[model samples]
Target: MAITREEVLHVARLARLSMSPAEADKMREQLDNILAYIRQLDRLDTADVVPTSHAVEMGTPFRDDSVHPFEEKEEILKNAPDREGDFFRVPRIIED
Candidate 1:
């Protein structure tokens, strides 16, 4: 399939692009080549092939989720510049 200069101009207009006549001619040739390649691919027989999202088969490698207790709350709070009770305090951002 060949892409015409008119089609290229129409596409460029849709994309709001401004190109010179030379650029348009170049784009037409490039688009035509791309379309020709795609048309060539249409001739391939893949009726029995199953569709896959990835080129290679892979499985999710996940470890068992385990809960661990953090016993250093006081140690972590000791480094806070502004501590309020058991938590770090910050400037109030919301206004009533």
Candidate 2:
């Protein structure tokens, strides 16, 4: 499919972009090339092909959740500039 210069200008206006005549011409060419590539891809035979979210096979990247209790409570709390018992004290932001 060939992209028109007017269509490119219309898209630019919709996107709130200020395009010069030269820039619009360039954009029109690039969009035309992309559409041509898509048209080329449409000629492929994919009757036996499976639709997938990714191009390659993917496995779950996440590990099984395992709870591990933290041991150094006092040692960690020692770094706090201000603490109220086991919690860090911060200035009250909301008046309730």
Candidate 3:
């Protein structure tokens, strides 16, 4: 597929890019080459090949989730500038 100057200009407009005539010509050539490479891939015979998301097999390496209570609540609250009972007091942002 040969990309034209008009197609390049349209793409540039959609992308909100300002290109000179020389830049558009250069982009047209580059885009045409990329399309030609993809056209070459269309000629491949992969009827028996299975579709895969990744080139290599992979698995999630995540650990099991576990919960625990804080050992020292008073120690943690000591760092807060403003506190009320067991929680830190923050300034009210929204008027009800």
TM-score of 3: 0.47
Off by over 4 Å in 2: 45-96
Residues forming the 10-long window of minimal summed lDDT in candidate 1: 37-46
Q: What is the lDDT of residue 88 in candidate 2?
A: 91
Please list the C-alpha lDDT of all candidates, in the order they appear: 0.90, 0.89, 0.90
Write the number of the candidate with greater lDDT, choosing between 2 and 3: 3
Residue-pair clash count for candidate 1: 0
lDDT of 3 by residue, 10-72 (tens): 999999999999999999999999999888867888898888788878886886698687899
Model 2 lowest lDDT segment of ten: 51-60
Q: Tens-digit lDDT track for model 2 on 1-82?
A: 4989999999899999998999999999999999998888678898888887887787879967998889999998999899
Query: Each prediction's Cα RMSD?
Result: 12.3, 10.6, 10.8
Q: lDDT winner among the candidates? A: 3
Best by TM-score: 3
TM-score per candidate: 0.46, 0.45, 0.47
lDDT of 3 at 5: 95
The residue pairs that clash in candidate 2, if any, are none
All candidates in order of lDDT, best leading:
3, 1, 2
